[model samples]
Target: MDITGAAAVVTGGASGIGAATVRMLAARGAKVVVADLNEAAGVALAREVGGSFVKVDVTSTEDLVAAVDEAESLGPVRVLVNSAGIGWAQRTVGRDGRYASAADLDAFKRVVAINLVGTYDAIRLAATAMSRTEPLDTGERGAIVNLSSVAAFDGQIGQAAYSASKGGVVGMTLPVARDLAAIGVRVNTVAPGLVDTPIYGEGEASEAFKANLAQGVLFPKRLGGPSEIASMIVEAVTNSYLNAETIRVDGGIRMQPK
Candidate 1:
């Protein structure tokens, strides 16, 4: 799909992969909307990319609608990147080996709510807006890219909640694409390995920790970069032939059981 003059909404656009995507899309001549809860970073990045910033909590439909409206105000909404997500770690049964110490139900639900439900909320709102636009020569109105994780498949210990949430994204890709096919909208997903993002802190200790984590990678012997993942996301959006697929940007790491 041609994105020139089109508008794109990127959740979690404040930093990491989302920020990289906003920059790339802007360079491609698409008007971008930085939709994120990080007001400061979102505003800064939007200004740098010559886009608009909308504070959005993905779990909130009202916030998502405002973001879609903001994108529409810029141009036709043709792209949406569901990059906003959160993670939590705890085995279904905790360290104490007792039901009372099992992973907090509230925590698990919160992770699924934010990572899975929030993603769908953004997709539905944006797809609705995209449906209203005129179709292009290829009969395509828009494309969507949702962020999953290697955990969705190669889930390790303590990843139950994160895996379930991301797995839902993978599970829904083809069906969601089929559902939106009638409207000429395509859905795809990108499941990344360990990408270097702010979630990892900086410092000698952090670097050493990350370096150790990199040992598991099949090749490139390092964590993935946000820009690397963003490149694939941009391709997913611009490549009209790619649809209903979940591409793993990881360097062939299958993740070990912890």
Candidate 2:
């Protein structure tokens, strides 16, 4: 699909990979709506890209629906990027020496709700809107890109909830693509490795952990940048043939068991 003048919605656009996607899509002449919970950063990015900002909590259906409405006001949402996700570092059992408690269950539920269900919400709403647009030469009306992680496939210790949530994303791409095919909408995902995003803490990793990561990659020998991931997303949207696939942009890193 040609992105020029297309309306796009990028969730989690306030920072990190989402922020990079917003910038890249805007530069490609797509009118972007930066949907995020961080009001300040969302508005700032909106200004930077000459796009709109919709303060949205992906976990809240009301918030997501409202964001879709706001974005539709700008233009038809022909592109949807589900980049809002949270990372967790706790085991099913907690560091507090307790088994998975009610609080832990709640946290897991929240993560699944935000990362998986929330992504579906945006896709459903945006595809509905896109279906209303005239089809392009490739019979494509729109495209949706979801963010997964290498952890989805190669989950380490202490990543049960995070991995499960992202795995759900990876698993859904093909089915979602098939479901949307008749309407000329495509769905795909990107599974990134240790990215230079704040999802990891600011401090450098321990030498042991760094060495472990190094062993997984054949080259580049470092974390990926948000721009690199964004580039893949752009290609996924523009390349009509690239559908129902999860492209791993992880510098050949297949993570180790921690």
State each model's CA lDDT, in order: 0.95, 0.87
Q: Identify the runs in model 1 with alpha carbons over 4 angstroms from their true place.
A: none
Poorest 10 consecutive residues by lDDT, candidate 1 = 90-99
The C-alpha stretches of model 2 lying farther than 4 A from their native spots are 94-103, 201-215
Tell me the tens digit of each residue's lDDT in model 1 across 38-67: 999999999998999999988889999999
Lowest lDDT block of 10, candidate 2: 94-103
Q: How does candidate 2 score on lDDT? A: 0.87
Tell me each candidate's TM-score.
Answer: 0.98, 0.92
lDDT of 2 at 135: 85
Residue 65 lDDT (model 2): 78
Residue 123 displacement (Å), model 1: 0.8
Clashing residue pair totals per candidate (backbone < 3 A): 0, 0
